[model samples]
Target chain A: MADVIKTATRDAYGKALVELGGINDKVVVLDADLAAATKTGMFKKAFPERFFDSGIAEGNMMGVAAGLATTGYTVFASTFAMFAAGRAYEQVRNSIAYPNLNVKIGATHAGISVGEDGASHQCCEDIALMRAIPNMVIINPADDVEARAAVLAAAEYVGPVYMRFGRLAVPRIFDEDYKFEWGKAVVLSEGADVTICATGLMVKEAIEAKELLAAEGISAEIINVHTIKPLDKETILASAAKTGAIVTAEEHSIIGGLGSAVAEAVCESGKGVPVVRLGVNDEFGRSGPAVELLHIYGLDAQNIVAKAKQAISLK
Target chain B: MDAVIRKQLKIKACKARMGIIEGVFNAKSGHPGGSLSCADILTYLYFNHMNVDPQNPKDENRDRFVLSKGHAAPALYSVLALRGYFPVEELKTLRKSDSMLQGHPSVKYTPGVDMSTGSLGQGISAACGMALGAKLGGKSFRVFTVLGDGEIQEGQVWEAAMYASAKGLDNLVAVVDNNGLQIDGKISEVNSPYPIPEKFRAFGWNVIEIDAHSFDEIDAAFNAAAEFKGKPSVIIANSVKGKGVSFMEDQVSWHGSAPNAEQYEQAMSELQQALAELEA
Candidate 1:
C-alpha cells in the first residue's frame, strides 16, 4: 500500500470541475438544487456566474445542458443517479444523445452504495438505461484519480457522456501520474488462472480479492473497466483467451451492469470461457450502512474471491 | 410596418401554409392544425424579426430558434425552406425515409434548426440555456422558442420558466401558440393552462399577448421583447386551431391528421387564392 488517500468520487468530480473552469472558460456547470450533496457547490463557489442551479428539476436541467452545448459551451449537469438516469432518461436521450450534444452528465450516489436512502434514492439500473441511448459514452470511475481524469476527459469529448460517481469514500487505487484512457481497460494486476473485470466501486473489491486469491495460490488478473458503454472488447477478449475464466464485479444489479456487459462481450467473441458474476441479484437496496450493504449484496472481496474460484472450477 | 412589408409577409406566410399542406399530404401523416395556426408567427420570426442567414445557419453570432411545440414541424420546415436553408422542393420529403425533414425539428438533420425537439416542454429549457450562454459569453445574440398551449401542462415547462426568470435571461423570448386544442380535444376540456399570462407573470417574466395571425402584433411583440431588460419575455399568441383553412378551423381531428388528395387540393386552392389576394 502506497499510503492510500480515501475520498468520494463526487468530491473529486467537484474539484475537477473547479480545475476545468479555470482552464476552460467555456466550461459551465448545472445542478438541480443538489449542489451541496453532489459537491457541485465547489464549482458554484469558484464561479458563481457560470454555475446554474436548476432548482430541483432534473429533466429541465438536462435540456438546459443540451441547449448550452449547442451554444459552444461544454456543460456538466449533476444530479443523483436515480433522477438523472431514471427520471430524466427521456430528456437525456432526446435532448442530449439524439443530437449528440456536448453535455457531460455527472451523476453521483449511484448503486446500493448510496446508503440510508434505500431503494428510492439508490440507482441500480442506471448503466442499463444510459447504455441504451445512442451516442452516449458511459464512464464509471473507481477512485479519486480516475474520477478526476474521467471528468476532464468528458469535458474534452464533444458528445453526450454519463459519468457515474459514488457517495462513499473509497481508497485511492491509482496514483497522481496515472494516465486515464477512454475505452481502454487498465490492468492493475496480472494473473493466469482467471480474469476479474470490475467497474466503479467494485474495482477496489476486485483488488482486495486479487490479494486474497494470491494468498490461496490462485492467480487472478484484475482489470479496471472505466468506460462501460464502448467496452474494451479487445482487452477483455485477450484476457479471456489467456485465462479461459472470468469474474465480473459491480455494485449494481447482476442483470444489467458490468456482469452483463462482460457476458455479452464473451458471448459475442464465441469464447467458451465460463464467467461468474458477483453483484446484487435482482433486488432493491435497504436503508443500511454502505459497507454493510456491500457485504449483504455480495459485492465484497470475499464474494469476488468466491466467484473467481467458481469461474475457474467451471473452466 | 408598411403595407408593402405586411403584404410581402402575408404572401410569404400563405406560401408557407401551402408548403405545410404539401408536406403533410405527401407524408400521409403529420400535424397540420397547429402548423397552420403557427405559420404566421414562424413567418414573422424567420422573415421579419430574426437576424439569421440561411447560408450561415450555424454561425455562432446568429439568432437561434427552437420550435418547442415540435409537433408543428411542418410549419418550421416550411419557413426554413422558404428562407433558403434548403430547397423549397425538399418540403415534399417531410417525414419520408432518407430525408432530412424528420417528423419533428432535428438540429442534426435540419440546417436552420438550432435545437432538436419533439417531446414537449423541453425546448424552452434549451432556449433558456442558449440565453444563459449568451449572457455568460457576453454575446448579443438572442434565442426564440415557440410552445404549444397544451404543452404548458408539463411540469418541466414551469421549471424552465422559473430558471429563466431567476437567471435574468432578457435575451430570450418564448411564444405560446394558444390554438386551444391538443391531440385529444380542447385544451380547457383536457387540462387548461388558463390565465397563461398570469402564470408567466408569477414566474417573473415580461408577458405579452398578441393575435398570432396579425403580422403587426407579432412584429410589435418581438420588438417589445427585445426592449425589455432583466427578465425573459413570453408572447401568448391567441390563434385559431386551423387559421387559413375554413374546414379545418377549430377541428381537433386535424391536429395530427394529414390531408387526402381532395383535401390537399382544397387547401392548395384556398392558399393560392390568399396568395393572389396578397399579391394583388
Candidate 2:
C-alpha cells in the first residue's frame, strides 16, 4: 500500500539545477569529486565552463564555493551531506554563512537510504548542524517533485542555503507544475485528531501514516516542512491549535532536526499540545536494506502511525 | 626612492602604526604583536601600492587584499578606517559587540574588507578562488593575501599553495609574515616552518626574502612580485613578533595580551616618539 510513488530525488536535483543554470549565468555548480553521486552530472553536461570540480578536497571546495559566491556568482556546491555539513562546518560558518554569501549547498545522501555505505557516509546529523548556523536556510524536500522545486528555489534565493536530499527512490508527492516557496509548509492533508509535521523523506512516510490512521477512523493532518530554518510557525501553530495533538518526524536526529523545530514552534505558541517526535534517538545507523533500515530505525509509516495514535491518547 | 615619495611612504607607515596602536590600546583586548608586525606591509599596500577606492570598496577592478591570518584585525580595521572606509572614531569600538571591528575580519560588517577570514589556512584558498574568478571573468585585477608563518603549519595552506602554483596564479601575491612566534610558543618549537622560501620555490612560486621592517625591501618585493609572470609569488617577510615595542619585541606572551594601564601609557609614549622621529 505504501509503494505508490517511486522516483530518484537526485534526478530531480540534476534536472532542476540544469534548468536553473540555463537562465541564471551566475548560477555555477561545484562538486567535490562526487558529481555522479550527487547527480550534478546534468549541470556539468550543460554548463561545463561554469561547473567546477574541486577534486576530493571538501574543505577547500567549501572555501572555493564561498569565494566564488562572494564575486556575484550564485554557486550551488553539491556533494554528500556528510561532507558538506560535517567535513567543512567551519568554512560554512565563517566563509559562507557568516558573510551571508549566496551559496546553495545541495547535499544528497541524506539518512539511512545511503545504505551499504554505512553510517560514515549517511549524514543524519547534517540538518541539526546546519540549523545551528545563524543565516543558513535548511531545506529538506519530501520527494522528487519537491526536491526539484527546492533546488530551483535555492538557486533563486539569496544567502547560504542547505538543501538535503536522499539517495533512495521515494514517492513523487507533488505535481509537475508545483512551485517551491521558502518558509512555507505544504499541507498535504488536513485533519482534527492529530497533526503530523515532517520533513525530507519522512514527509512521504507521514503521508502513508495518514492513510493508515484514516483506515482506523483517525484524521491525521500531514504537513510537509520543506524549509526548516525559516519554519512556517503560523501553519504549524494553526495545525497544533486545531488538532490539539501533534507528532513530528524526520530522517535526522531527534535533538535538533525538524522534530525539534516543530517542538520549539509548539512550545513558543504555548499550545501545550502532546508533541511526539519520531527520529534517530542519539544513535548511529548501520548498513542494511532500505526498508529494513527504516523499520529498524522506527521510521516507517507504522511507527509514525503508532506515535500519532499515542499522541491522540494523550489528547 | 625619490625624496618626496619616500617621505610620503614613511609618513603613511607611521600613520598605519599609529592607527594600529590606537585601536589595540582602546580595545584593551586584541592581537597587538601580529598587528604591529604586519603594519609596514599593510601600510605599503593600502596607502601607496594597492589601487583601491575608499569611496567604492566593492569596485570590481580594484586591487584585492585578504588578510589570511585575520587575527591582525586591528591593523586592517585601522587601515580601512584611516582610509575613510568608515569613521575613524569607530576604531575605538574594536571587538566590541554591535561594532564592525570584530575579532576577525568580516566583509559584511566592515568596509574595504574583501573577504571575511578567521580560520587559518582557509583564506589562501579563498584568495586562490578569487584569482581564478578574476581570470574567468576576464578581469585583469591582481589579488594579494597576507599569511602568518605560524599559520603555514595547517596542511590546507600547502594545498592552496600547490593549487595556486599549478594554475599559474601570477596575479596572486602572498606575503608571509615570518614572525617566529605563534600563540603557544616559537614557530621552531611549535612546528618548524624552515626553508620557507625554498618550499614556496619548490611549489613553483617566485620567492622573495626581505627584511620585513625595511620599507625599501618591502617596496622591492612588491616590484619583484609584479615582474614575475605565469607563477604565484611569496614575499617571505622576516619580522620580529612585536616589531616596534622594545619590551614586546619577539615576545610570545604579547601575541594577544593587552597592556596593563601602566604598560599602555608606556606603549603609547613609545609609539608617539616613533611617529615624531619618522616625521623629523
Q: For each candidate, what is the lDDT?
A: 0.93, 0.87
Model 2 lDDT tens row, B3-95? 777677666666666676677777888898998899888888988788899999899888889999999988898778777899878887888
Off by over 4 Å in 2: A1-5
Q: What is the lDDT of candidate 2?
A: 0.87
lDDT of 2 by residue, A1-315 (tens): 666678778878988889998988878888888999898989999989888887777777778787777677888888999999999888888888998988889899988888888899878899999999999999888888888888877777889999898888887788889888778998888998999999888888898899999999999999999999989999999999999999999988898898898888888876689899999889899998876787889988999999999999987
TM-score of chain B of each: 0.99, 0.97
Q: Tell me the alpha-carbon RMSD of every candidate.
A: 1.1, 1.9
What is candidate 1's lDDT per residue for A1-315, written digit by digit as tens? 356799999999999999999999999999999999999999999999899889889998999999999999999999999999999999999999999999999999999989998989989999989988989999999999999999999988889999999999999988899899978998888899999999998999999999999999999999999999899989998999999999999888888788899999999898779988888888899999998988888889999999998999998
DockQ of each: 0.87, 0.69
Q: Candidate 1, which segments miss by more than 4 Å at Cα?
A: A1-3
**Candidate 1 chain A least-lDDT 10 residues:** A1-10
Q: Between which residue pairs do clashes occur in model 2?
A: none
